[model samples]
Target: MIREQLEKADAIEARIQEKKQDGAGPEELEMLRIEKARMLRPLTHPNANERVYLARRIDRPHLKDFIPNLFTDFLEMKGDHLYGDDHAILGGIAFFHGRAVSVVGHCKGHSAEENLACCFGMPRPEGYRKALRIMEEAEKFQRPILTFIDTPGAYPGKDAEEHGQGEAIARNLAAMSRLTVPVISIVTGEGNSGGALAIGVANRILMLEYAVYSVLSPEGFASILWKDASRAPEAAGKMHLTAEDLVEAGVVDEIVPEPLGGAQEDPGRLYASLDKAIQEALCSFDGMMPEEIRAQRWEKFRRIGNGE
Candidate 1:
C-alpha cells in the first residue's frame, strides 16, 4: 500500500511537470498540487518497515554529501599513525560556521565499485585508529568534534580481528570519553554495534528522523532471536530502534526532522535543517570548561538505559 501511494504521488508529480512545460495556468497547477497532497496522505505517517527502508536507501544522503553542504574549507586527513589509511572511514579538519572543527564519518558508496572501495562502509581496525588520531588532534587544538555515523558495524573479518579491531574500537571509546573538546554525533543512517559507538561518545547525540541506531540491525536481531531474518519488521518494532524511540528513551538528545518523503527525496532542505541543528548544538557548549564538557559526556553515557 505504501509503494502504491508513492507510485501514485510520483505519477501525479509527473503530470504536474508535464502540464507546466505545456504552459498550464495557476488554477491548473494549484489543482494538481492539491491532488498530489491527497495522494500522499497515507504516507505521512510511515510505519517501522518504511522508516527502515528509507533509512537504508542507497541513494540517501551520505557523509560526502553532508560535508560539502554543512562545512567549508574541508582538509581531508588520512591514515592511522600505526598503519595505512582506511577508505571506509573519512576524517578531516573542516570549518563549521567559520569555526575550525574536526569531522569524521562512515562513507558508503552509491555504486557497486564505490562500495567495494569503501568495503561497504565497514571500517577495519586501522579505520578506528585513524578516527582516534583525528579526534586526538581535535582535542589538542580544542576544536569541537563532529561525527556522522552510518555503518552496520565494524569489519568482522579475520584480518580486522588479527589487526586488533576490538582494541582499536575500545581505545576510541576511552579516548573520546575524555576528549577535552565538545563532541557531537549524528546518526545519518544505520548506527550499528561497536563500530558506531567507537565514534559515538559525544556531548550531544542527534539522529535524523528516519535514521536508526541500535546494537545490531533488525534483520540480525531477528535472526538471532527467532532464527528468521524475514521477521525483521517484527524485530524492529520490538527493538525500539527508531529515532523517536531513542529520543523518548533519552538515548538521543534531539531528532532532526527530515524532508517530506525522507532525506533522499529532498537533500537541500535536510542539509539546511541539519546545519542549523549542528550550529546550535555546538553553541550550547560555549564558554564551558573542558572538565565540565567531559563530565557531562560521562554522566550522559552512564544515564543511558537507566531511565535517567
Candidate 2:
C-alpha cells in the first residue's frame, strides 16, 4: 500500500518539478503541487515494516534539510581534534528563534554520491567526538543542546574500532547524562543502535510519526538471533520499533507528525510543526536551574520502561 503511495507521490513531485523548470504558470504549478499531491494517501494504520520504509524513503527530509529550515545562523564546526572531520556526523552552533544553541545530527545526503561521501550517515569515532566537542561547548556557554538522530549505527569497520568507537560512544553517554543545560533530541528518521543513542540521551526525545528507533536494525537482529536476514520483517514486528511503540514505552516524549505522503511531499508543513515542538520543549526548560534541568533529565531516563 505504502509502496504504491510512494510511487504516486514521486510521479506527482516529478511532474511538478518538470513543469516549474519548463516555466509553467504559477496557478498550474500550484495546482499540481497541491491538488495533485492530495491524490497521494497514507495508510490508516500502517504496519511497522511499512513505517520503516517510510522512515527510510530517499525523499524524506534529512538533517541537512531540517537544519536550514529549522534554525538560523548555522555555523558548522568540524574535526574531532584527534582525527580529520567525518562528514557522517555534522555539528556546530546555531540560533533557535534568536537563542544560541548547539546543533548536531547525522547527515545522510540526498544523492547517491553524497550518501557515499557521508558513509550513509554511519559515523566513526571521530564523528561522535566532534558532536561531543560542539555539545561540550554548549555546556560551557550554558546553551541548550539540540541533536537530530538518524543513523543505522556507528561505523563497524575495523578502522572505527581501532579509533575507539565504543569508548567514544560511552564518553558521550556519560557526558550527556551529566549536562546541566537542556538536551533535546529529535529522531527525524531511522534511529538504531549506539550511533543514534550516542547523541540521543536527552531531557526530551521527539520522533517523527514515521521514524523508527531501535536497538538495532531488524536485519541485524535477525542475522544475530535467527542466523537469517530473511526474517527481518518478523524481527521488526517483534522489535516494536515504531514511534507509536516508543512513545507508549516512554522512550519518546512526543511524536512530530508528518504530512500525508510523508515529510518529502510537504516539507514546509513538517518544518512548521517541528518548529512549534522545539519551541514548546525549549520553553519547558525556561527558568529551570542548571541542576534542576540535569536532575529532570536523569529522572526521566531512570523512569523509562521501569513503570514509574
Candidate 3:
C-alpha cells in the first residue's frame, strides 16, 4: 500500500519538476502541490515495515548526498585499524562555517547492492571502533564532532558478535562521554539501539521531523509484546520515537523541522536547516570550558527520567 503511494508520489514529483522546466503556470504548480500532498500525507503515518521502507526509500537522502551539499573541502578518513574499514560509518574532517570539525555519519546505499554492502546502515564492530577513533582524533585537535545517526542498529550476525560489537559500542559511549570537545548528534532517519548511541553520546541531540529513534524498532517491540508485527503502528505511537515526542520527553534537545512533507522531499532544504542548526549549536558553546560542557551534558541526560 505504501509502496503504491510512494510510486505515485514519485510520479507526481517528476511531473512537477518537468512542468517547472517547461515554465509551469501557477495553476499547474498548485495542482501538482495538491497531488504531492496526498501522497505525502499518507506517508506521514507509516506502519513499521513502512517506517523501515521509508528509511530505505530511494528518494530518502543519505549522509554522503547531503554532506557535499552542506560543507566544503570534506576530506574523508578511513579504517578503524583493527578489524577493517566499515563502509557504514564514514568519518573525516570538514569545514563547517569556516571552522574545521570532524563529522561522522552512517552511510546507506541508494540501491539493493549498495545496501548489502552497507549492511542496511547496520554497523558492525569495526564501524563503532572507527567512530571512536575519529572522535578521539577530534578531541586531540580540539575540534567539535558532529555525528549524523541513521542506523537501524548494530549488526546482529554472528560474525559481528565474534568481533566484539558490544565492547566497541561501550568504548564509544565511555570515550565520547569524557571527551572534552563538544559533540552534536543529529538523527536524520532511523536511529535504532546501541548502533545509534555508540555515537549518540552528544552534548546536543537533534532529530528530523519524520525520523525515529529507539532502542528497538516498532515491529520488534510489537513482536515481543503482542506477538504480531502488524501491531507496530500502535507500538510506534507508544515508543515515542518521533522527534516531537523525543523533545517533549527530554531525550532530544531540539526538533529540526523537515521540509513541508519530509526530508526526502527536499534534501537541499533539509541540509540547509541542519547546517544552520549545527552552526548555532557550535556558537552557543564557544566560551565554555571542557569541564563545563561535560557537566552540562551529564546533567542533561541525568534529568531525562526525572518527573516534572
Q: Best-fitting candidate, measured by TM-score?
A: 2
Please give the distance, in angstroms, between residue 188's alpha carbon in candidate 3 and its true position after superposition: 0.3
Q: Per-residue alpha-carbon lDDT of model 2 for 201-286, expressed as tens digits?
A: 99999999988999999999999999999998899899989988988999999999988767787899999999999999999999
How many clashes (backbone atoms < 3 Å, residues ≥3 apart in a chain or on different chains) does model 2 have? 0
Clashing pairs in 1: none
Tally clashing residue pairs in candidate 3. 0
Residue 191 in candidate 2, Cα distance off native in Å: 0.3
lDDT of 3 by residue, 18-72 (tens): 9999998989899998989877786666654555556546567888886888778
Candidate 3: pairs in clash: none
The root-mean-square deviation over C-alpha atoms between each candidate and the true structure, in angstroms, is 2.3, 1.8, 2.6
Kindly indicate the candidate among 1 and 3 with the higher lDDT.
Answer: 1
Q: Model 2 TM-score? A: 0.95
Q: Candidate 1 or 3, higher TM-score?
A: 1
Q: Which candidate model has the greater lDDT, 2 or 3?
A: 2
Q: Which ten residues in a row are the worst by lDDT in model 2? A: 35-44
lDDT of 1 by residue, 103-129 (tens): 999999888898899998899999999
* lDDT score for residue 127 of model 2: 97
